[model samples]
Target chain A: MKTAIDIENVSFAYNEQPVIRNVSMTIESGDFLGLIGPNGSGKTTLLKIMLGLQLPDSGSVELFGTPANEFAEGTRLGYVSQHSTDADSMMRVTVREVVEMGRYPHAGLRRLTDKDHQIIDDALKTVEIEEYADRRISNLSGGQRQRAYIARALASEADLLALDEPTVGVDADVVDQFYELLTELNAEGITIVLIEHDIAKVSEYAETMACLDGELYEHSATSEFLKSGALERAFSSARAVSSRSVTRGD
Target chain B: MATETTRQRRELGAVALGIPLVLLAFIVFVVWVFPPLFELFWNGMEQLFNEHWLVSSSFLQHGFTAGVLIGFTAPVVGSYLVNRQMALIGEALAHTAFGGVAIGLFVGASIPVLNYPLLWALVVAAIAALGMQYIAVNTDGYADIPIAIMLTGGFAVGIAVISYGVVFSATVESYLFGDILFVPFENVQLMVGLTLLVGLVVGLTHKQLKFITFDREAARLARINVWLYDTLLIVLTALVVVAAMQILGAILVAGMLVIPVAAAMQVTNSFNRGMLISIVFGQIAVIGGILSSYYLGIATGPMIILVAIGIYLLAIVR
Candidate 1:
């Protein structure tokens, strides 16, 4: 099987405080990876490293057999970050324009072609936001705005979607719809790597789970994570409570 | 989405905001600066006009050109800087250019080989602009701290040169507070070229710039070079700041960059519309300020800024 990501003994720090400590992990192609940890356990930092936004202090990351630093084909991967909605309100472009920005990487000194426009419209329809295509993004609801960002990522036509807390500030009812949309996209076979603080929540969608507590245990399946005491040893009290909440009906 | 009626109303509001500039310019030119001089030079100008047809006084020509170009260019770039919430950087770079002006003056006095104050200002201001970004990135200081440091550091150097008596221009007080009296035709040509370059580059990269400003991290994720665009935006800002100093002056160019864009935002619904409206407001400020300065014998920079403020107040009310 082709490996989608290969991280080797990576460690990182900020202002002399260590974050990711000698963590190694591999995510195979087509695997939905759920990276979960405590609030300060550096899940977002790790995600940033995987996407080449920030370089790790030591060790290396290989994306699709190319080193993260040398990976020239960034359009092959899509990313949605936290606070994306906040930036949306400051800009005055329409939702369609916002989604079309995803084509910039491929457009490359030329205007969008018919195929690019078709892809953008398709992405918006996939996210069910074709209604607000002409409307400014500032007018959209939080969930709808997030969908716009997803449409932006989707418009890139990437094979891998790496989202950092996509549902952090969104309301609960919308979050279910958001996750359902993700599942639908996953059903279409795009690989997903989602970062979350709660293992229980992400375990619902992720087949493979990595519990990071300054270090990584990447090979645990969701079923083993629930049955084994491995999570109790690696996580803080918050995860323990969330773990109980997830296992209650089971 | 704004309906057609609302859009028409918004455009009307922008034009209305622009009306006072016309009145102020009319009062300044017809009432004050040109009364005695217009009488003395009217026949000479008319005869020259008959021969050359475009014959105008260097002052009027330079002032008119500077006012219009600054009007068109300042707010286009200013809108991006304002939307990014980096308005202070504009102020800082102007001071850097001011220091450059001082350096140019001093060098011309001591060396006599080099003498263009405006060109020197551009060079130093560009360096200072890039330096501020460098300081902000390489150091642990706050973002605004680098700006604050550059702001005062550049001005402190300028003040020191003035105090040393090496760079003070006693006759050209207009250089201190902005005046059209001393602007040579050659300098107007420079402003014209600079305006064209700034306008062209900005027009080409506007969409990419919009993306970078909207969400830098997302832009980076999508393979946009965030650092390159950020540097480009700041460097372009430095160029505009240098270009605007002829009318708004160094002490007051920030007003041109910020106020017009602020006022325009109140009247328009979208980014591109707001930017277009901002250029209109900026033109009003410049034309009105130049006219008033010529007639009333007031400082042009302050006059322009005050007009912009009044327009801003009116925009808020509407």
Candidate 2:
């Protein structure tokens, strides 16, 4: 299997205190990788470093074999941020317009061609939100908005998808649906790197798991992870009990 | 759009209705008590709407052409500013242009070689915009910090120059509120060129500008230079504001940049359509204001803005 992401001995600091210290992890291609931790556990920071949105104080990130800083193939990697709506809602734009923005990186020499439209429509169909394509984005529900974002990621036609707390403001039921959609996409041969705080949801869909608490605790198969109690060190006792119960049920 | 309701159409009608009422008021005022202050175009009043084509007088020709050019460019660029919530940038640069006006007047009085205050206003406004962008980058203040600083600083320098009466007092009012009728052919030619430049730049970069305004981070991620687009937008605004100051007045310049977009926003659901509506509304405001001020003896700047305010009121009721 190809190595999709290689994060090496990375440490980042805010002011003086370290937020991410000596953390390293690797994601193999075709793996559904879930990264879970407590609040401020540097999960988002790690994702940012990989996407070149943030630089680590030490060590490095390699995306699909190229150094993150020198990686010029950004179009081959799809990213969905948490604050996607905040800046976008300022303009009066439709869902189709937002999804079309994904093609901008690859829109060379010509405007959106017939092939591009087919892909965009397929992305919408994949997310099952095709009916809302012409509606203004601000008019959609939270789940619908996430579906639109996922469609944008799909439209990029990248093999790897990186999500940063994508289910942040979603309800419990909606989160289940979101994870199920991720599982379906993962089964369809896309490598997914999901940064989530919901341990229950992450355990249900992630084939491989990494526990982080400002430091890497373990990276192993989900079955091996569940056999051990690595989450105990990362989460509080109450959360550990509920998360264990949720994972055991899965 | 099919979604455009009857209420919206009626609200737009309210806006259209204001122009004729204003025109009637001017007509009654002209017939009631003829003011010699407008002895410039009192004759051939019957051709007031289409009189610019007649070229009946040089003043009317210059005034009408300048006003129409300003009408189009202000909203073309203003739509982006309003969407980005940077409408105050226009107000800031207009005041900064006043400082340029003061410098030109003083220098012209001393040297008698540099006599165009509007040209100086353009230079100062452009530099001030770039300088403010620089300060915004180096300072810890918010995005609007430079605009706020330039606004007060520019006005202070302009007011001080005039108060000192250092060759800036006698000709200050024309620059302050605009003297569109008295514009030289050279300045009118410059306005034409500036207006065309604004139109061309905006037309060429419309999608990129919209992308930056909509999502700067995403645009950056897509390899679009957000900084370059931001600078281009601000510089274009500087050009538009300086050209408009002499026709729209420095104090009222923000009105042209904001109110028409606001009115358009109330009616249109998309940014492109909103911009188109804004340009049309700006034309009505400028043209109607010019005709009213000519007939009723009022400052063209205030007259245009008052008509804009009436349009805003009509939009608000929707």
Candidate 3:
């Protein structure tokens, strides 16, 4: 199988404070990899690096064989950030307009054609938000807004989808539906890299799982990962360190 | 269902009216397909008004033409800036342009050939815009810090230049407090050219600009060259500021960029529709202010801004 993302000894620091240290992993094409960790495990930063949104302080990243810094095919990648739903509340944009942004990378400088419109419609339909297409994005519920973002990804025809805590503010039932949609898309041969705080929930949908606590603890199939106690080790290790700091403070 | 049908019909009506006008604007401004379109428009206005002095006089003609073009270009560019919460950038650029004008006047006192203050304003404003963009991107402080610095720093420079050179206070005051009667025919033509450049640039890069305005991180992820587009937008704002400074003055110029879009946003949910409506509102303000200023014998700059504020209040009330 072709590799979707290849990270080799990637290390990143914020103001000389290392956040990601000697972390390395490879995501194969069509893999639904759920990356779970405690808060500030550098999961989001790693995702951004993989998507070429940031540069690593050391080592390298490759997206589909090209160096991450040099990778320019934006059309093949779709990113739904953690703050996506809440960031543009003041913007007066319709759902269809938000979805149409997916096609922007495809139709640079030229007007959207009939085929582009058709793809956008298909994307909206896929997310089942065609009914709300004309409505203002700000007026939509959190669940509906996420669907709009997913539809945008669909419209872009992106083979790889990267989401950072995409269901943070969503309701419980809506989160399940959102993951089911991810599952369906993954089955349709799209590669998904998702960072979710809910470990059990992500493990249920993800075929592969990776745990990170400043560094990679484990990367394996979800079933094996659950049995291997890597999640517990990663979490307990962080807890141990925090408790040690507390004891020292006393 | 009835409301839905009405909304659809209204949308269709807007599209129908919009397409022709957009095509006309592109042809007239971008391609210069019909250089006589303005003459035809003025002649029609003169004939309709029975050869009134306001419509027949060449000074008023040039002033009105310049006003209408500023009305068109300012709000279109302002839509992006306002939505991005960078509305004050216009104010900053205008102040920098004022500085440039002061320098131009000082230099022109010695050299007759380099007397075009607007030309100098364009150069200084564009450079300051790029400098502002660089600082905003590279620094890690409050976004408004650079804006405040530019705003005050540019004004200080202008004041220093004016005081040192002993430039004519009357000539400087016209630019500071905009005189509609001061616009020349060549400036009107320059307005047309600026309008064309703005229209073409916005038309081509609307998607990129819209995407960046709504979400900077996503635009970067899309490899849309967020820095380049941000720079492009700031430069465009500078160009519009220089073009608009002739009629709106340094103080009120940002009003032409902010107020119309603010009012339009109050009424519409779609950015594209809001942009179109803002242009409509801008035209109304320009025309209303010019006519009111003519009759009331008030300053056209403040008159236009007050008209725009009135529209905003009305939109809010609605």
Candidate 4:
């Protein structure tokens, strides 16, 4: 299998404070990899670095054999960030309009063709949100909104989908359905890298799991990863450091 | 699939060739065609209204023409700016254009050919816009901090330049507070060129602009050249501001950019629809303001703004 993402010794800092420290990993094509870490453990930062949304302070990342920062075929990758749901924004855009953005990378200074519209419609149908195509994005429920985003990714014809905390405010039943959708997409040979807080839920769905706490603790098949005890170590150490910092601040 | 690829290639080739050709054609239209076309429009309006002085008088004709063009262009560009929470950037650019006008006047008194204050205003406002975009992207702190600085700093520079004995004529006050009757035929022509240019550019880039405005992060990830679009939108705003400065004045110019869009947002659930509605509301405000100014002896700029505000209140209640 081809490598979808390759990160080597990548270190990142915000205001000189390191967020991701020498993190190294490789995500294979069509792999469903679950990246789980505590809040502020740099999962989001690592995802961004891999996507070339942010440059690392040190080391490097590659997407499909090209250096990530130089990778310009953006239509091949779809990203759903933590703030993907613009619930608070007053931007009055329809769901169809939002989905139409998926075609923008392909359209590029030209009008959308009938073929593009067909692709958009197919994506909307794939996500089962065809009924809400004309509704304002803000008017949708959280799960419905997430489905719209996934449809956008589908419309882009993205081979790699990176989702960060995609189910933050979703209900439990809907979250299950959402994960099932991810599994279906992954089975369809689209590579997925998900950042979720729920360890068991991720482990059940992900073929591989990686534990992170400013650094990679372990990365392996889901069964081996669960048996590795890396999660306990990473979480416990993070607790110790955070408590220590709290005391020092006081 | 092969046919699709071929078709797309053809489209791409057309676009590659089309943009420069379209811009060149628009320039030709503006230069050789628009003045006569505008004269014909006014002549028709005059005859349609039985040669009423409001339509026939050259002063009202120029003012009304300029006002209507501003009505269409400002709100169209403003839709993106307002939705992006960069509304005040328009105000800041207007102030910078004011400074440019002062410098242009000061310099023109010395040199004979460089007397077009609006031209100077365009140059200064465009530069200031790029500078603000740079600062907003590179520097820390809220986006508005730089905007606020540009706002006051620009006005301060204008005041200083004007105080330096730069023949502060009623023309300066007209640019400051806006005087509809003060528009010249040449300036009206400038507004027509600007309106067409703005309309063309916005029409071409509406998808990119709307995408970025609705979601900046997703736009950047999609390799939409977020920074380039940001610069383009701000520069367009500067163009609109400078063009509007003649009739709306610097202080009131931002109102035209902001008010119509705000009202449209209150009524519509789709961004594209909101843009269209805002343009309609802008036309209403401009026409209503011109008529009110004629009958009630009020300032055209303020009356336009007030009419827009009235529409906004009505929209909110609805």
> Which is better, 1 or 2, measured by DockQ?
1
Task: Return the TM-score for candidate 2, rounded to 2 decimals.
Answer: 0.83
Task: Write down the TM-score of every candidate.
Answer: 0.84, 0.83, 0.92, 0.95
Model 2: CA > 4 A from native: A84-87, A108-119, A236-250, B1-55, B163-165, B168-170
Candidate 1 error regions (>4 Å): A84-93, A197-201, A236-250, B1-56, B110-113, B166-172, B292-297
Candidate 2, residues B1-318, lDDT tens digits: the string is 011124433543664676577556545544443334234444445267465533567677678777888889999898888878888999999999998898888778777778878888888998998898788767787878888899999999988877675763446877777777767766766776677567756765676687677766555545454566678888999999988888877888999999988898887667777889999999999988988888898978899999988888898897
Chain B TM-score for each model?
0.81, 0.81, 0.88, 0.94
Among all windows of 10 consecutive residues in model 3 chain B, the one with the lowest summed lDDT is B1-10
Candidate 4 whole-model C-alpha lDDT, 0 to 1:
0.88
Model 1 lDDT, residue B191, Cα: 72
Task: Note the DockQ of each predicted structure.
Answer: 0.21, 0.17, 0.31, 0.43
lDDT of 4 by residue, B137-195 (tens): 89989989999999999999888999995576797999999998889877887887788
Steric collisions counted per model: 2, 0, 0, 0
User: Relative to the unseen true structure, what is the C-alpha lDDT of residue B93 in candidate 4, on a scale of 0 to 100?
Assistant: 98
Model 1, residue B1: C-alpha shift (Å): 40
The superposed Cα distance between candidate 4 and the true structure at residue A133, in angstroms, equals: 1.4
| Candidate achieving the largest TM-score | 4
**Weakest ten-residue segment in model 3 chain A by summed lDDT:** A241-250
